[model samples]
Target: MTAFNPITISCFKAYDVRGELDVNLDNAIAYRIGRAFAQYLNDGKENPVIVVGSDIRPSSESLKQSAIDGITDAGIDVIDLGMVGTEEVYFATSHYNAIGGIEVTASHNPINYNGLKMVRENSRPISGDTGLADIRAIAERGEFVVADKGRVTLNTDKTAYIDKLMSFTDTTKFTPKKIVVNSGNGSAGPVVDELQKRLGDNIELIKVHHTPDGSFPNGIPNPMIIANQKATSDAVIAHGADFGVAFDGDFDRCFLFDEKGRFIEGSYIVGMLAEVFLKKHQGESIVYDPRVIYNTENVIAQNGGTPAISKSGHSFIKQVMRETRAIYGGEMSAHHYFRDFAYCDSGMIVWLLVIELLSVTGKTLSELVNGHINDFPSSGELNFRLGQKTASEISELLEQKYHSSNPAKNTLDGLSLDFGNWRFNLRSSNTEPLIRLNIETKGDKALLKTKTDEILAVLDECGAVSADH
Candidate 1:
């Protein structure tokens, strides 16, 4: 008699699989995940192929190899795209007409961690409710149907993916400009180099930390961290560049800095991208998350476009984009999605579109976003680590206190209260043990500060410590 041993995998999250290496994930787990994913997505299709890729993490190569072995063992052909960004897998899945794809990357997580982002045919996201849960169940069960092993092939071509990016705008219109690009020693360097060749001599790129280093000597490539942003910001100022762009580990999110080396909040970037897209495709719907609304809402309305709101997350945004047929969708967290890009988010596309907007309009990055920033002063996202108190308890307390003010409310993704001129959104982090807060007001810098402080006081009362501290 064979014994059945049930294994528990804690890496599977609401949207993707992320875990601490050797703890929640390893080569064994990666292999099982790949086998399960192939089984779940095959759907009796013949010659089923799965595209696989990995980032620059030291552990990613072996993990990817194990995944490929498992997929091929399950009679699924594998296309190995060695050491690429997450979006590249998305591109390959749709571009090659594969059954599905997986990218072995932990993104901006700590070095001890690694994870995987997956998508089905046509690059459709496989979230928890989609196919991730089934994959998780299969992986946990550790059961597989026997079949003839398949073959593996290598595909390192980025030409098609780069071509698709260039299709977003007219390259001939790119004016001569010096730009600072910091890849944060992650997977973005190779792609940036490819872009430089296509960009020609008209645009000078001042590259910083533009190498793939697994050690992450310059820190984890997370531009959202204030400390990690200095390298990009300082390079921009030192080189006297027009603007600067920084990316995370997998390069799925790109953060921007103005000529003055001032970090531009993601919400403001969302508003600017919304306006850019609307101008090109008039009356098209633009989807945005519920984190900060006034700036994005105003921009969409003024540009003759409808604003579609969705919960904050890649899966939610992509689903909303498809349902609304939105031309572009962006989150204040620096994720930007395009309809043409198989509804997948790409940091590369975001910068390309921004550069095109800059050249065609003959406007500086600041010149374009300054008005929106002034009109809708925002508190930028604030993170708080809770102590004893739960997010719900804190939210309920805030609601009870402000209920008498008659502020309009919405619970789309979290607790959002709009008091006519001022609004705020408080939600727990989807990926971390923290709570996020964003505040915005109508053209009132002083009010923005006042309200921001007011909210901080309330959070402090709830024993929530600022993540910054």
Candidate 2:
């Protein structure tokens, strides 16, 4: 008998199921998860159908097929939406009225990785307590208890998804603007290629590394990495286009760059997107993650819309958006979810809106987004491994020390403390065994450093390093 790794059997996490491909997320485990998910959602129904989608990663096909077989074996039907992003799965599930959906994607991870994110009815996400842990536990046991097997179906080429995205906004107003898009060579290539062909040369899009190369030749599809953004920024400057846009592996999170070759931090993108969405549909509420500065709230409010601050996870943001009927939601991590897209995030949709924003505003990308260079400097999303420590342990100690006494502290996501005029959030990673921290403060750059140092000192006491883990 071969030895089994616990990480593989126990890796389905709070937000979704993720780990390295082949090692933790192999076909056998995917098969079991499919069966387990079908059983869990069906509750002994006649025939529960699920919509399955996968990105363009090489291994996605095999894993998705195995999951489909597992679900079918458990007497559930699978509607395969092949080669689509996560948002498309959400759309198919909701549109077709399936029990739930599964999207096989690793969103922004390195080339050697892959995983899955699941949702129950109404496109609601399945997380740790919500159901991921149970699914992982069932898959690990690897025992089959099914009397009748289900069926598997296929539906590729998401024409409706693409059309719906285009219909959500009035592109005519935003046309005639030359924009640059670099999709980081993930699953976004086909979608971007089609969009460029449809939009024609009038947009002057500079598509770089937008092909479906699972090898990730142009560095992983993550645009947030300074290393990955180099090509996009250079292309923007070289082509003399207005700005640049890049997508992650599954094209869910988008990062931006100005014509002057400056990376606009994602917090600004969240705020800018919020403003644009509110302007289009007057008084629509916007959802925002708690990691970045609350400037998003101010921007949405100033734009005559309500701003609802939610936790940092995509699932949390989507839930908040659905509950509040928010027009749009954005996290500082570059994930932007939309209610119009069945409460799922889409990097392509976000970039499309930004293009319209530029055309309608008639201002340079820098001019429109520069004013929001984060009045409060922040250390975006910093991850620190906690060997034997959990966020709860550190959070308990710090609450009384800083937050409880301050009385103005916020625990909406994790622990957000406001010391005088500065603020920061010390939270746990939704998917990893790491302690995540974010520090933001007013225009005073020195104060930002001091606050960050203070938090770091406390985290160090709990055996966390200041360096990225």
Top-scoring candidate (TM-score): 1
Error of 2 at 155 (Å): 2.2
* CA displacement after TM-score superposition, residue 91 of candidate 2 (Å): 1.7
List runs of model 1 lying over 4 Å from the truth.
1-4
Candidate 1, residue 86: how far the Cα is off, in Å: 0.5
Spell out the clash pairs found in candidate 2.
72-150, 189-210
Cα lDDT computed for each candidate against the true fold: 0.92, 0.78
| Deviation in Å, model 1, residue 90 alpha carbon | 0.7
Q: Compute the lDDT for candidate 2.
A: 0.78
Candidate 1, position 310, lDDT: 97
Per residue, candidate 1 scores C-alpha lDDT tens digits across 270-372 of: 9998988898899999999999989899989899999899999999999999999999999999999999999999999888777788888898999988998
TM-scores for the candidates: 0.98, 0.89
